[model samples]
Target: MPDGLILPIANQKDYIRAALEAGKHVLSEKPVAKNLEEAHELITCDTETDWRKNPVHQGGFLLDGGVHYVAGLRRLLESQPSSKVCRLSSFTTLLQSHLPPVDTINAILKLESGVSGTYQQSVGTSLTGSEWTVGYEHGVVSVAGSKVVVTVAGNTEVNIIEDERTGVPPVVRIWAEAIAAGITVKDLEPEEALADLEVLELMLRSGESDGLSMSCQYQHIVSNPN
Candidate 1:
């Protein structure tokens, strides 16, 4: 029997539940489920088996790809216990005719820590660049491609990460080591992944309701102090 399973997004809950019953640890790909309800089911029980164009895939590329951005944003914010996103309002639309349902999203997220930020993503845009920025009480940090810039007290510092690899490598390494050692990696926990999905899903839901504010239900409180 295999030790773990890396699953696709479609009908993921069934597959995950089956694998767990078979005594196999699972490392599923992002967008853990189609919506909040399905994701919740996985916590009590539990992809492609092209989320991109499939309406059945919920947010299409948004949920399939947007989860990563949500996760990254959370990490960059250094979210504390109960500091997860609590409410959000978003507007979603399609700029490209080819991308079905929607392709662009602009959202304002309010966290439990009383901090708020904006999120924007679009697969249909002609523009070709990506950046994540977080403002602190004394400084601001911004990441563009492999470069990270920090500004504080009228001073600025820039650092370029030479490696081009994304987070996949280290994530896989940790999963492998955890399986070998009979332990669980907190960062890889299903709840953590669920929180990522919840944020994205809430944004989509808010978009559907014409940017009505949506509250989050499954924001996980980080156990370890940062």
Candidate 2:
């Protein structure tokens, strides 16, 4: 039997449960599951297949791609102990005919620590820029394309990271290391992935409800060591 299982997004529930039952560690691609119910099943058990473009798959490419942004946003906010997202309101729409179901989302998120932020994602926009910015009490960090700029006290610092394979390699390395050491990495845990999915799913649900406020159920708050 293989020591670990790396699975694609399709039919993940069965595969993850089977692998876990076989005593193998598993790493599956994003979104975790199609919905919160399926995600919960996988937590008791648990990407992209061509079905990603099919409307039956729900949110189509939005769900396929949006999970990454949600995960990144969660990581950024969780830098503090009480920063987990507690609720959100969102609006979603399809900006391009080619991207079915929906291809854009704009959301307002409120964190457990009482901080708030905006999240916007679009796959079919004429706009030509990419950025993920997080503001802190003392500074702001903005990542755009290959550069990360940090502004603090009126001073700005920039760092260029030109890796095209950015997050994949590091996550794969961590998963491998965790497996080899027979331990779980907190970030790679199924629950963490589920939390990521929960945020996205609620956003989609909120979008479908015309931006009704949705509460998050799976956010995991990490305690600060200090």
Candidate 3:
């Protein structure tokens, strides 16, 4: 909660910690917290319910926020029986003003079987595109603008072409299903999300050091999950 907003604590660290301690499922704003430690604790905790903290919604980007990309990754990983993430990459833009300013850049995530491509924005012209593409062992998955397309190497091309409108679509619905089924549902589970946060932290740190490689260490300690 931010100071003036009647939000619990403006510091994301405090907000997330309190939410977990209270055993309340949460759907937070994007860029979950200010740092990785807060995000890590929020995600890694062995909670008994589903909690979502995404800045995209809070930032007013609607469903096209960070949630979409993470959800997509989760879908690919779960649907593929033998798939794993190999590596991931992201690209961002500093020049966005026409629409939402997506402070977070692009991401390229590599799965054991292939790669996942994601682009996000906060403020850019509607004409500017925000898309996601996944390359799997069997085929390729591409989501451009409001359309989703999938093509398998030898299988028939099943095109899921539609318009983007209203609340959660297939992406968020997946998480909803997991929750309804009493399953611990999280796109890039807490720990994994924290890992991604740390990766971003390292990237920023490295950039600050003129692209010189650097190490990231977490100082906020959590009680053992055991």
Candidate 4:
């Protein structure tokens, strides 16, 4: 293992363990493990409770704090009625022919007392952009990258936000600066990161079950490593 590794490849937990065992620190890809148990095993082995020693990040959403995008999709649904996701049906498919593997997954969320909504992700289709929308009986709200749109009562409003992710320096520099400051990044804390992995694992399990619905609840990992 290299002294400071930035691993974006799959088998993320394995690489982290190997790097730590070889006296190296690593920043690995997000959803740090295929599931929560593996993440726990890695955290237990770290022993110092140092977060930077094994941080996790999603590729493009590195600075965007995207864990909330998956686990907390229910919060967005709250705009409709129910804030809890009772169950969800999901399926992943191979859509990108040249890129080689399956890159799209669509999930339909069933809310307890609100309008059911869909969460679809595609790699090479026309729906390649990142946009989130919430629909209610009275109005609709949508966010697309840096822009937000709302329509209700025969009136429409638009707002634009600065895209902080577009102009950041390389991650290596950010990592170095944060390390020098001696603090855990609030966005990647155990609570947020672990919940992201947990939701994702449940999604994959749902897909593997051939669209059988999967259930989830927001959870945090309580740890006192070393």
- Structural similarity to truth (TM-score) of each candidate: 0.86, 0.84, 0.52, 0.65
- Candidate 3, 1-226: lDDT as tens digits: 3121124323655665666666654545445554565565665553533343321122234222444455444544556543444444444444545444334444444444544444343444445555666665688777765566778876645455564564335535665565567565444245544543454544333333444533434312232221
Q: After superposition, how far is residue 195 of candidate 2 from its true place, in Å?
A: 0.8
TM-score of 3: 0.52
Instruction: For each candidate in turn, give its C-alpha RMSD to the true structure in angstroms.
Output: 6.8, 7.2, 7.9, 6.0
Q: Pick by TM-score: which candidate is best?
A: 1
Number of the top lDDT candidate: 1
Looking at candidate 2, the ten consecutive residues that score lowest on lDDT are 46-55
Across 46-107, the per-residue lDDT of candidate 2 in tens digits comes to 22222112213578787888888788778767777789999999999988988988899999
Ranking by lDDT: 1, 2, 4, 3
Give lDDT tens digits, candidate 1, residues 1-226.
4455555677778887677565555777887788878876776563221211121677779888889988888877654765678899999998888887889999999988787889999998887778998888899989998899999997999999886367777787898887787566677877788889988988888898999999987776443221
- State the displacement of the C-alpha of residue 120, model 2, in Å, after optimal TM-score superposition: 0.7
Candidate 1 lDDT for residue 65: 88
Judged by lDDT against the true structure, how good is candidate 1? 0.79
Please give, for residues 160-187, the per-residue lDDT of candidate 4 as tens digits: 9765565223444565555567555544
Candidate 4: where are CA atoms >4 Å away? 1-4, 14-29, 43-86, 97-101, 112-115, 166-186, 217-226
